[model samples]
Target: MSILINIEDLLSGSIVEGTRMEFKKGWNPVPIMRSICAFANDFENEGSGYIIVGVDEVDGKPIRPFEGFNPTNLERVEKELVGYCNLIQPSYFPRLSLEAVDGKHVLVIWCPAGANRPYKVPDDVTAKHKSYNYRIRFRSNSIIPNDEQTTELIQLTAKIPFDDRVNTFASVTDLSKSLMREHLQETNSKLYEESEEMPLEELAEKMNLSQGAKEHLFPKNVGLLMFSRKSQEYFKGAVIELVEFPNGLENPYTEKQFEGTIQKQLIDVLAYIKTNVIKTKVIKYTDREKSDRFFNYPYDAIEEAIANAVFHRNYELQDPIEIRILPEAIEIISYNGADPSLKQTDFDKGRVRARRYRNRRIGEFLKELRLTEGRGTGIPTIVKSLADNGSPVPIFDANEPERLHFIVEIPIHPKFIEQGNNQVSDQVSDQVSDQVISIIKYCSSPKSRQEILNFLGLKNHSMNFKRNVQPLIEGGYIDYTIKENLKDRNQKYVATDFGKSVLIKIE
Candidate 1:
């Protein structure tokens, strides 16, 4: 039993004798009932507090321990307390306990704050007449409620807010016309011009925004998202934040904040990624043949991820969407508000039908943008792009009623050159070596220098490779045949049987 008070501690303080902490002698039901109510009410305001019994008072304060109450009488006290609470607030019952300290009996009643507020005494005329009403104040002081305070108490207990409160500050004028125009063009270019002069509200209605209406209350959907300028303002909890960590982990070295519309945020976030996250590197296959490359994550896959976040996130949740970039993987998190429709089994079996978006309107708009394709293709696209590039499949995990998190692990491929006796040496640098290997290992059977460079994720550094690859041919590791049809004198490097043998030995 928790010792809320000791005899010595009680003696040292000004404790009211008959409120929660003090008990008057005899079967004083009125004071005890009021104490229960006060204790229950206080629990709502100040978390938890205890009511103690069997303590004596001097000057309205407990100075010495009163003789313990009879153990046999505890059953009566328990029954009465339960009856009182049930008659008062049927939904909430305070937990009660009895204990003995220094041969004296004390009653400890614990009340929990009600989850549904404004609990009232049950509506039985006879019970209401018999039950007591009292308020608990600081220390043990008990006060008979005045009319004003009693009415205030009733008001405090009964107040509950409705769920669908509209934002009066947000109007149709805040929407972006240009963004809506773009979406219209993508969804049906023929109707784009026809709908140009339509009222924003009419457009919102025509797009089936009220399709899932319940009790005449329709939530703002995807069409509103594509057009709304102050969408975040209208939807108080909707915001997307992209954070970039220097080491790609919990502690971020730098962070950028983006708000307003999801489309604008997406564009800004992608630009930030291009500028800060991706890097280029050169991998040398031999002393003569060096390949220029970039990181292994496909640009298309990343775009799909961003589009997914914007379209699928639960805007009803007050949590912001997050993108975390780590050294080994990238994580995208959207507020899901309970388990997602898609499961690990669905992903494993390549069953796209199981996935459902929380925001259908936003998803359709993204599809119109060509940011995503027909039903359930985005995740597969992400998986295939990574796999085709020799990268690992992205992992997806759903957090119930809160978030859906996706982790894409960018695979690093290593270039191997075989000597003999199964001894392989990596002939690539760490920077872009993995990307270079992926290109060499997966490209069509044999490719031109330009073709290999492009396939190896080297589209950005075409000029650098053109100037630097000659040394590899001179080193005897790579051989190229001269063909008049090939405008460049050095047209292609068909890795010789010796080169393949070397690669095999290294592997």
Candidate 2:
């Protein structure tokens, strides 16, 4: 089966980087085995690399309009590959696909990161006297690792990244065809066109979303995260919790929880924020015709911050990704801090590049969806977005002694903060007139409108309630308990943090 990627994109080095691809004019087993061994090592934990034969390349780029491989030799090549692949110490075999690019047949070798890594092969597979050495990819070329690098490769033994590991609890049937097809379609992969005709198991294999012997295939963790709505069942706390504090964290705040496929959650949360939380403000000056336009918190900055949290958080941990939208700033918290290679200095300068990713496969899926730019640009992107909006530099708090969690605190725009403070003061001083303070204190806990009116010794009238309580709600002192269904018969009123603060100041 063909690998789950756009063959055209792979050749053009658009999606996959040059470091992860090697092009050859012809099939030579000796060097091919070396590249295979190096790719299996996956020294940088950057997911799998591919090798394409029957295509010539200069400076690691494929020369198009390639001379095609002989059609008659296809079977011969496959048969020989089996014997030659076994020469590696761990016996690794790459997935082979004959794809037609520019009407020429090129052999695409899909060398996924091996579960058993640090593989070694004979330097010369054809020589009478063989020398086996550990091989790894250095940029675009495959070469034997030196002593120091070899030691590092050995340390990676049996340390396959979590996302790539097989999920024994899940059967191939657990994989959703619709979600998988949707991803393939979104990525513009050739596999999507043939997905409908393929069996579930066959499709899973073609996509590299399943593992184990063919008789008892199981879905990989990455596959479930990308393709299953029930991913939360397997991965605990695999959801996003968003809390908004118009006043402060010390008072009552509205909350929402998002659960689904990670991609779905990401898209849904972003939409929710844009519709409800994000706000734009215009500042006009009498001396200037052009007004300054800026968002309270730039959407792009928030997008990168939350997307990075989702992509980097340890799924095994029970802590759900938490986004706290405070009046002064937004904080995105995720468990398991940045990689050790990232220093406080790096974070301070907004230049963080991880030595290796915690979830390489997860990064691959997110990048294809255009939700993230996976090559360690998440922090830099957030910094740039905030700077462009005239906001304060974002604060990264991953300096815990044990480095247990990662926190990104993005400050609100200065103008918005000032505006909010002024509005609150004005409401408390100027408009805290008729029964507003009494209503806020009465509704500290959730209370129906009629109950609040009865407490005030007033009759149940919509106009009275609007006059006494609507100002409190509009001033951010009160909130509807059922925010999504504001007009529900059972909806109740409650005092928000801002309202409690007002009562404390006046009373």
Compared with the true structure, what per-residue lDDT tens digits does model 2 show for residues 1-507? 566677886887656778788888998989988999999999998888899889998888777679767767889999989987888999998898888778778888999888888899999888889999999999888999999999999999999888899999988888899888877876667678888888888888878889888888899998888788679889878999999997898778888998988887787777566545666666666565666767778888999999988888888788899999898899999888877787878899899887888888887777766678747678899999999999999999986568898899999888775745322222222224335667788888999989998998866655345435665676687899999999999999999998889778765
State the lDDT at 282 in candidate 1. 37
Best-matching candidate per TM-score: 2
lDDT on C-alpha atoms for all candidate structures: 0.50, 0.82
Each candidate's number of clashing pairs is 19, 0
Q: List the residue pairs that clash in candidate 2.
A: none
Q: What TM-score would each prediction reach against the true structure?
A: 0.44, 0.79
lDDT digits (tens) for residues 206-258 of candidate 1:
44332233334343434345567666665666676777665646664666676
Local error of candidate 1 at 1, Å?
75
- Superposed model 2: Cα runs more than 4 Å off: 64-73, 285-289, 419-507
TM-score of 1: 0.44
